[model samples]
Target: MNIEVSTLAHSMLADLHNNNNNYGKAIPGHIPRVPPNIRNINRAAYDPKVLSIGPYHHGKPGLQAMEDHKKRYLREFLTYMPGELEKLEKLNSLIYSVRTLEEKLLSLYNQPLNIERDDFIKMIVLDGCFILRLLIKIRVRLESEADAIFEVVPLLRRDLLLLENQLPFFILEKLYELIPKPNSIQPFPTLKEMAFAYLTMKLSTDPIALNNLEAYHLLHFYDLILLPKPRDHLIFESNQNAPSTVPQASKQEEPGIKITAKKADNFLEVPFVEGKLQISCLEIKDVAIPIFRNLIAFEQCCPTAGNHLTDTRFMDLMV
Candidate 1:
C-alpha cells in the first residue's frame, strides 16, 4: 500500500510538470467574436452573407458556395508567375513562409481553432490569395463582364467588410508580395492602393489619401476611412464645450436651426457652425444597413478602435 501511494504521488507530480511545460506563452488575440449581448441583438448584421474571408465563418453552409470561387481565384493568382515551374516554386515558397508564421497567426484569433494545423494553413493561404486576387482584378478591371462573382460584387463587398470575416492584413500583404506583378508597361498600383480603390469604387467623393495608414484587417481599413482628418481635430476640439446632447431631429424643427447636406470626402463628418448643421451627403441603400451595423459592432467589440462611427453623431443622422 505504501509503495502504491508513493508511485501515485510521483505520477501526479509528473503530470503537473508536463502540463506546466505545455502551457506556452500566451499571446493576445486581435480578432474577437462579437459578444453575446451585442450579437444577440442583430445576428445577421455581424454574420457574413455570401463569402467568408477567415477561419471564424469559413465553412458555414451559406458561405460554402463561394469556396469554389476562392479556389478559382487561387488558380488565377498562381498564373501571374510566368512558367508552370516558376508557379510551383513560388507556391512552395509561400507555403514554407506561411508555415513559419503558424504560431503568430494562431495568436491573432480569440479562440483556439478546432482545425488541424495543415488545414488551418491551407485555409489561410487560400483565403489570403483570394483576397489579393480579387482586389487586383477589381483594380485592373480584369474580371470578365459575365463573371458570376462580379455579378454579386455588392454582396461580396458586404461580406468582405464584416467584422468577423477578416483575415489579418499582414497575411494579405505577404501573399501580395509573393505574387508577381502582371507584365505591363505602366506601373502596377500597390496593394494599399488597390484595396482603397476597391473599397471606394462607388463613392461619389474621393477618399482621403491613405498615405501612412496601417490597418489590422479589411474592416479596420474601412473604419480608418471614416476617421476625421487632422484639420477636423481642431473643429472637434472647439465643439468640446458644445451641448452634451444633440437635439432630436423632430426637436430641431424649432426656428433658427437649419440642417443641410454638404459634399465632403468622408461621410462621417458632421460639423455645426453658426446655427447651421452640415452633414456629409451619404446615399443610403439596403446594403448600407449591415455595413453600418458591422462597423458599429467592430467599434463595440474592440475598445482600442475609437468610436469613429458613434462619436461623430453619424448614427443619429443615419437613423
Candidate 2:
C-alpha cells in the first residue's frame, strides 16, 4: 500500500502543479531560468561541392552512377541530422532547470547529504542522458526522412555551437570526418573519460566509498559513451539459405521475448503483444525536450517527517 499512498500523493501534487501555481508562494523570487552553456563554432569541413565534382562521386568518367548513389546516401544524412541537432540544443537548456525535475528528484537532492556535490553530479548525469537520447532520436529520423534533404542545414547552423562544445566530452570527434558538415567546425581534442575523471578530481570523499555507493547508478551510463559502436543492429537471417534482415516480424510471438507488469483497476496495463516491445509510458512533449522520461522511486521514510506508514508488504512478497 506504500505504492497506493505514493500514487495518491503524486496525483494531488500533479493536480496542484497543473491547475494552480499556488505553492510558489512558499519560496518566491527564486532563480527562474537555467540556461546551458552554448559554444559557438566556426565551420571547417570538406567542401561538398568539390567532393561532388570529384570522379569518385561527382561523375568521374565511368563511375557517374556510383558517385550519384554515394551523393544520395550522404545527402540523406545531411537532411535529418540538423533537426536532431536543434533538439540537442533545446535539451541542454532544459536539464539545467530545477522546475523540470520530478518531485521525487527534488527530494533526492534536498535530503541530509551535502546538497551541492550531489546536485552537481545529478545535473551532469541527467544532462548527459538527455543528449545521448537526442542523438538516438536523430538516428531514427534520418532513416524515415530519406527522401527529404532540404531541412538539414538550418538545424545544424542553429546548434553548431552546442554540438561543438559537447563533442570534446563525448569523444565522438572522429565522426566529424564521416559527418563532416561542409564549412563547419575544425578538428579538436576529445575529453575522453569524463565522469570518472570528474569524480576523481573532486576526491574530497573516499574513492572506495564513492565507487561502492555509485555502483548501480553508475552502471547505467558512466561508460555508455565509451561503447565501441554507438549503434547496433538487431538483425535476423531469412529463409532459402540467404541472409536477410527482417524488417517486419513474420510471426507475433516468434521473437521469443516475454515482458510482464502489474496493473491497477483503472490505470494499470499489460500492453505487449506478439512481436513488439510496446513502451506505453513514453510520451514526448514538444518543449526544450521532454521534461521527463520514465518514473523513479524513493524509500525509507521517517516518522519525524510527519508521514504515516504505507502497506508495501505485498511488493516484498513478489520477491
Candidate 3:
C-alpha cells in the first residue's frame, strides 16, 4: 500500500511539472484587456461610448447602433475597389484574404475569443472597411450635410481612441493594400499618409514622424502621436538624487517658478529653462480628459511601451 501511494505521488508531481513546462512555452498576446481593478476605477475612460472596433467590446449594448453603420460603410468601401467584379465577388475575395490571417490576428489579443471563425473574419472585414471609408471621407471632404456620422464625429473620434477599441494596424494596412485607388491627377496617398492626416486633423497638435514606427493598433498610434520627437541636443539632464515624487503645480508657485504658455510644435514640449516653466499652448476641450485618461491607462497596462505620458518628468510639468 505504501509503495502504491509513493508512486501515485510521484506521478502527480511529474504531471504538474509537465503542465508548467507547457504553459511556459506559450507566448503571451500583445493586446491585453485592461485589468478589472483599473477598468473599475473609470469605466468610461476604457469603455467605448459609441463604437466598438475590436472583439473586446464588439457587440456591447450601447455600441450596437454603430453596427448598422459599419455594414453600410463596408458596402460603400467596396465601391472604391479597383476590380470590375461585382460587390459580392470583391467581398468574398477580401474575406478569403482576411481568413488566411486568422491565426495571426487571433494571436494579437491577450484572451482567447469565443467567436466563430466565420464571424471573426466578418468582424475584421467590417471594422477594417469602416475605418478605411472614414479615412477616405476625411481625406476628400466628401461627406453630405445629412450624414449622421459627421454630426457625431467627436464621439466617434473618442471611441476610436479608447484602449479597448482597436483593430490591429496590420489589418487596416492589408485591407488598404487590397483596394487600389482609381487613376487621378494627384498621386494616391499611402495608408500611413491617410492615417496621419486623420490623426492630425483634430487629435494631434502637430504632425509626428511615422517613417519607421510600427503601430500595434489605433490607440497605440495615438500614443505614438503624443510622444515628443527626439531633439539633436539634450534639453537638460536631471540630478541623480532628485526626489521621486512629482510636485503639484500649486507647489511650484511657492518656489517663485512662473508657468507660462509658449507656442511650440507639439503639446508634449514642456521645457524648464532658468526656473521658468514654459509649457506649450494646449486647448483643454471635453475630449481632452478622456484622451489623457486612456493614454495614461495604456501606459500603465503596457509597461514595455514605455511611460512617455505617465513618467514623473511629464507629470511634474503637467501637474
Quick one: ranking by TM-score, best first? Answer: 1, 3, 2
Better of 2 and 3 by TM-score: 3
TM-score of each: 0.81, 0.17, 0.79
Clashing pairs in 3: none
Winner on TM-score between 1 and 2 is 1
Local distance difference test scores for all models: 0.76, 0.29, 0.74
- Candidate 2 lDDT by residue in tens digits, 1-319: 5999999999999876665422222221111111111101112221122112211122335423333433344333345345877645433443333334334233322123233544443433333333332232233232444333224423322221121112122212222223323233233211222233332222223334333321112211222211222122332345335332322322323567443333322111223456433423323343212111000010011112111112224223322
Stretches > 4 Å off in candidate 3: 1-29, 81-86, 143-146, 202-208, 235-258, 281-283, 312-319
Residue-level lDDT tens digits of model 3 in 109-157: 7544678888899999999988888887777655555567887778888
Which parts of model 2 have CA positions greater than 4 angstroms off? 1-105, 108-110, 115-128, 131-135, 138-319
Q: lDDT score of model 2? A: 0.29
The RMSD (Cα, Å) of candidate 3 is: 4.7
Candidate 1 residue 267 Cα shift, in angstroms, is: 2.1
TM accuracy, model 3 = 0.79
Residue-wise C-alpha lDDT for candidate 1, range 1-319, written one tens digit per residue: 6999999999999887655421222322276676678789888888888888778887889888889988888888778788999989988877877898888887777554678898888898888888888888888877556567888889888988887788888878887778766676267777777888788884323434673677888888888877866664445465368566666765675867777879987776667678877877678798878888788877766676777774647357434
* Top model number, lDDT: 1
